[model samples]
Target: MSAEEIRRAAAERIEEAEDVRDELCAALHGAGVVLPSLRVEPAAYADERPRPLVELGRCNLRTARLIAEALRRGGAGA
Candidate 1:
């Protein structure tokens, strides 16, 4: 998806959970909003494999920051 699309998706997911604040941070990281390491716990129950940030049905902070960078570089579609 496009960078803007990823950005918006990240924003939406961040808005969904207070605990996901760090996740939002990661998304921003993806957007080039640099910060220290973000701590994200697995949003899963016992006996289940933890899902990747992307598998959360949206882009995480890292992806968002990268997408933002891509957008700035005219590579958003990538």
Candidate 2:
């Protein structure tokens, strides 16, 4: 993607992630807890994997939705 497109995507992701994180914090606060940092374990690797070990990545608002969904599924959506 072009630099402009990349910047736009990053900005959107930041905004969306911030919004979701804030909502999550508020919900946790109501439940007498503070939200902590996200900790993702490394994915298992296999020699037969089709993709390369290192791959280019992009971020956008969709990532925010994913994060929110993950937290909900983990029972952090109090």
Candidate 3:
């Protein structure tokens, strides 16, 4: 594919990854689990490489426990 096509695809992938991040954040919120650093990793799309990534960055211990509990109770993860 052309450079423009590759760029467009990467852009689309990044957009989709961002959408997924938002959805996950919202879902976690509904489950009372908040990860302040949740985001799309810029590096994933930096070189227009394949596959974008949604990053759930570090959260505090309390938040980590909350997420674990939520998962245990089959909350948002279910």
Candidate 4:
């Protein structure tokens, strides 16, 4: 895929993942489990050819695992 196509696909996936994370957070909150704030940030490096990166931040180990499982069930992960 071209750079533009790659970026577009990445953006769509990022949005989907964000939705899943939000839902997971809501469920956790309802269950009285407080999680750290989650944010998606650009993760591009100053390398030869930089691409887009969707970094999920502010999650501890347990939160990360929970988010991964949620994404997988939502068909956003492998």
Instruction: List all candidate RMSDs to the true structure.
Output: 14.9, 13.1, 2.3, 7.5
User: Which 10 successive residues of model 2 have the least lDDT summed?
Assistant: 47-56
**lDDT (CA) per prediction:** 0.52, 0.47, 0.86, 0.58
Q: Best-fitting candidate, measured by TM-score?
A: 3
All candidates' TM-scores?
0.25, 0.42, 0.85, 0.47
| Best of the two (1, 3) by lDDT | 3
Per-residue CA lDDT of model 3 for 1-78, tens digit only, reads 999998888888888998999999998999899888898887876666658778899988999999898888885565
**What number of backbone clashes does candidate 1 have, counting pairs of residues 3 or more apart or in separate chains?**
12
> Which candidate, 2 or 4, would have the higher TM-score against the true structure?
4
Model 1: per-residue lDDT, tens digit, 1-78? 887776666555544543575666666656666444444434522113333242233556776676667567756455
Please provide, for model 2 over 3-42, each residue's C-alpha lDDT reduced to its tens digit, 9 standing for 90 to 100: 7776666556555555665675566556444335431112
Query: For model 3, what is the alpha-carbon lDDT of residue 23?
Result: 96
Better of 1 and 2 by lDDT: 1
| Candidate 3 colliding pairs | none
Candidate 1 lands at a TM-score of: 0.25
Better of 1 and 3 by TM-score: 3
Cα displacement (angstroms), candidate 1, residue 74, comes to: 53
Residue 8 lDDT (model 3): 87
